[model samples]
Target: MSITNRYLNQLGPQLTERDLAIIRDVGRFKLMSGGQLERLYFADCSDTSRARNRQAVLRRLTGHRVLARVGQRRVGGAQRGSASYLYTLDVAGQHLAQSTSSRPRRPYSWYEPTVAHFLAVAELYVTLTEAARGGRFTVLDFQAEPYCWRSFGHRTLKPDAFVQLGVVHPDGRRRKGSFFIEVDRANQYGAKIETKLPQYLAYYQHHRQTWPDQSFPRVVFLAPHEQRVSYLRRLVAERPEAQRLFTVGLLDELVAVTLDR
Candidate 1:
């Protein structure tokens, strides 16, 4: 007989089909592994009240072994020092309940997506650095959290990736300075010139002064799509100094520039 049927046989007719359905759904929810299940329960029991209790009872009845500890992905916020724990379940323990798919997914707020994209770009930055014949430079997360404000303070700034270049200028000048790559895949049309450009200008001006060393600080604003290039022109027009500090171009153009290096 099927495992679910065998388990249901013991639970008896007293268990309604609906109850069985719930058990099946709760137990077999393999969409998330054991660790994820534990995190869901611990984060807010209210949301998981029914499922959590059902899972606990089902495990006991089925003689399923519940592993004590598991690791959960880091969740940050006001509870900064807090950590996530995982709960592991044995084969039988995990079997009684059917895996669930309707469970709520973890949310990625505003900055999360931006930071994630930046990390992806940073990986490419590392590859480009290695290929450029420049000393390999480490990617910096200048856009992360509170650091973004401090690093790009006085500007409306969002950076994709930052790296220290190992190559010297063609003039044979000292191999000094780092580069800041600001990626704007789809950021456009927010309050237009009155509000947006000023922010970027401020950020660049502040960023330039923040560094103590004489090393050059350059900005490469990437607009992957052709449609986005117009915004770049507006940006330069509103903030003239940006012409000196930044280069606005499409992804293909950026690729061309980098690949030539």
Candidate 2:
């Protein structure tokens, strides 16, 4: 019964399967926009009808202290409707997620800086999901953040996301590939950020056979702009694995590159 998150304890009885699925998504993605939720879950409804229904579901979760609305209404025109608002799993939400997950997941308290990176990743998630839903691509698996993280020799390689996709070729054949994604906004400086590359290279060097595929996943670095892509490519150029294991591309190219046949 904390002041900020008052208890409803009215958890299980009122929750539907759809509600649980939404919770799982928030837990996995770290954060999501109201628009993302509507697209993923409420697409069955049309226009303003879907907006109203989504607002109701979100209000119900917030009342239960299972989801918390954070920050300002998104700029341009968010609070204007409901779509631009942002959401993250609340303390109670974490407990609800744990009830259904095989492995434990704990969400961090609301903060400002990490939101952009997380939301960027969430958008990629939406793209992949929509493509799969359209029947052209198959999302074999997607693990975000902690689930995608790898620990080897006392260090963890914390890629933004990990995915295995089934790609359909022009010839009507299919192929699969795995990748470790680093969605870089260039937020860090010098050694702090450069450490991630070496960590990934080292992991690839020593742990190739540990994956079920019996080889390391190609490491893809998605940056905000062409210059950023060039910058990351420069970093990759320094490493021996540069030509063999890494790829750097603009963020928007993710779906095309990942699902490329």
Candidate 3:
């Protein structure tokens, strides 16, 4: 955690603007997939060119130890490839990033479930930004975990992210939406998720000074697929009180739910 300004200065000369952004973003998300990086940094390129350019830069960064790859994810039983990599900051990268957050935020220490869950949250962040780019709404604010976490009564409700979106209605009135997002990769048991519902209900019903706004923000559960969505919907349905505020959907449906599209 201790580094001279000269050491930090030295990193800047060896990296590009894009390189620094990548380091900081990986630090921000705690973990990221290569595809997520390409979408954020190389969207202007053709699909083929983007993959080639992304891999080229990522390879060089790994060689420099400016970035580190954790593990490969198998896709539909396919073998590991560059796209399957999940990246975190290396030693040099940690110094460059100057971050000390996440689950220790150290390289090579994360379990596979931890990596997959964080990556899904990272993907949702990307999806929101891409949606805002379409001009229907503007991204007012977005906060990832710890920052997004809310504590009420005796317990804490940790959401993946907290989001605010600004929209201009046909009547020329501006409206803003606040939401708590929970991304599910199908990693937890149904019982575990069921426990989360009550925490949110308590957070909403209580008039705690900790709650950000007067009106309660909609709580969204984004699952990996429709089947997961159906299961979650059934669970939420069991709690008649939750039906009004809680909505369940596939992760890809995030923008539609948030942006009201």
User: Top model by lDDT, which number?
Assistant: 2
What's the ranking of the predictions by TM-score, best on top?
A: 2, 3, 1
User: Per-residue lDDT of 126-166 in model 3, one digit per residue for the tens?
Assistant: 88777777777888987876679887768788888898889
Report the CA-based lDDT of candidate 1 relative to the real structure. 0.43
Expressed as tens digits, the lDDT of each residue in 1-261 for candidate 2 is 562322434557679988998998988886898899988889879886898999889888887778888888867854445577788888788887777777656676666777887888888888788768877678898888778988888888888889999877778988788999888877742235567887887898667656655867888888888888888888888886556888888788888777652
Give, for candidate 1, the lowest lDDT window spanning 10 residues: 78-87
* Candidate 1: count of backbone clashes, pairs at least 3 residues apart or interchain: 15
For candidate 2, the lDDT comes to: 0.79
Residue 176 displacement (Å), model 3:
1.5
What lDDT would candidate 3 get against the real structure? 0.78
Q: Which residue pairs come into collision in candidate 2?
A: none
Q: lDDT by residue for model 1 over 1-261, one digit each (tens)?
A: 244656644644444454444343223221222333333333335653644554554344334232222234447542211123222333433443323323321222224334334333533443453344443332232232123323343334544455454444457654434556655657432233234345656765554587645544566667767677776767676666667766667765654443233
RMSD of every candidate to native, in Å, equals: 17.6, 3.2, 3.7
Candidate 1 vs candidate 2, lDDT winner = 2
Best by TM-score: 2
Instruction: Give the CA lDDT, 0 to 100, for residue 12 in model 2.
Output: 73
TM-score of every model versus the real structure: 0.40, 0.86, 0.83
- Supply the TM-score for candidate 1: 0.40
